[model samples]
Target: MGMNEHDQTKYIFAQSIKDLMAKQPLDKITVTDIVKHSGMTRQTFYRYFQDKYDLVNWYFEKLADKSFRQIGNSSTLKEGLVKKFTFLLNDQIFFMQAFQSKDYNNVENYDYQCILEFYKQIIHNKIGDIPEDIMFLLKMYCHGSITMTVEWAIRGMKESPEMIADLLIDALPPKLEDLLSDLR
Candidate 1:
């Protein structure tokens, strides 16, 4: 499908940010730099994004959506969780630096929402009635897992994504365990 002008501009801007992120801290990056890198005028940049923070938020949101879609059809919760985290940690060094920067503070919350929505869909599909307590537990697990993942990536994803996924699967609640096992 052809991308609209807005999407094209947004894509260029996002690529600019990703390119700059490798060379400098997020705080050090400016809209001017983005414009220059993207080969778009400053006015064009402003037309698409209010500021760099807005661009950062949009980038993370897009990544989260992509990750969720990639793992949305897993047969087991363990597999789903692993796929999700694996996607997040795949760009380990970039994410580690990006998530730690002040510019990306909202990225964590955005990621959390994505994780919640992804699991909510899965739970709703598997069992129409997901108890409130179970829902809460699942949310907590998602947040905790992502938090640990952020820390791990920052610390250098020293271990493999599979190892992290295994640890997370081992920590699942009994209800989740049963659900995931049943799927397997």
Candidate 2:
């Protein structure tokens, strides 16, 4: 499908920030630089994203959508995780910088929300709505996973993507483990 004008505009900003990120850290990059690099106006950039960090989160979400949407009947969850870790490893520099932010809307927080929702959907499909206590456990699982992932990226990702994926899946809580057993 063809991208709408809005998506095209977002891509323009995304590319501009990505190019600038290669030259400097994310904190060093500014909205003016992104707009100028894209040959767009500050008003246009603000219309699309609140700040560069928001754009970064959007970029990560876009990547997640592409990577996680394929996790279905044909693909195992571990395979999906391998794809995710490999994607992050391939863009280690960009992600390393992204994960350095301690802001409220940091990439880690975004990742937790995405992962929690992803697994919640899987459970919903398997058994219907999750109970509050079980949902709490799931949240804890996602939070720990995201924290470990951020640390993994910050540590220069010394571990292999496959190894990390395997380790993460193995760390699943027992209830979630049983729920997702078929996917493994």
How do all models score by TM-score? Answer: 0.81, 0.89
Report, for every candidate in turn, its global Cα lDDT versus the true structure: 0.75, 0.86
The window of 10 residues in a row where model 1 has the poorest summed lDDT is 175-184
How many pairs in model 1 have backbone atoms within 3 A of each other, for residues 3 or more apart or on separate chains, i.e. clashes? 0
RMSD of each predicted structure: 2.7, 1.9
lDDT of 2 at 70: 60
CA lDDT, candidate 2, residue 8: 94
lDDT of 2 by residue, 41-142 (tens): 999999989999899999998887777656654257788888889889888888888887787887888888888888888899888989998898899889
The candidate that achieves the highest lDDT relative to the unseen native structure: 2
- Off-target runs (Cα >4 Å) in candidate 1 are 103-105, 180-184
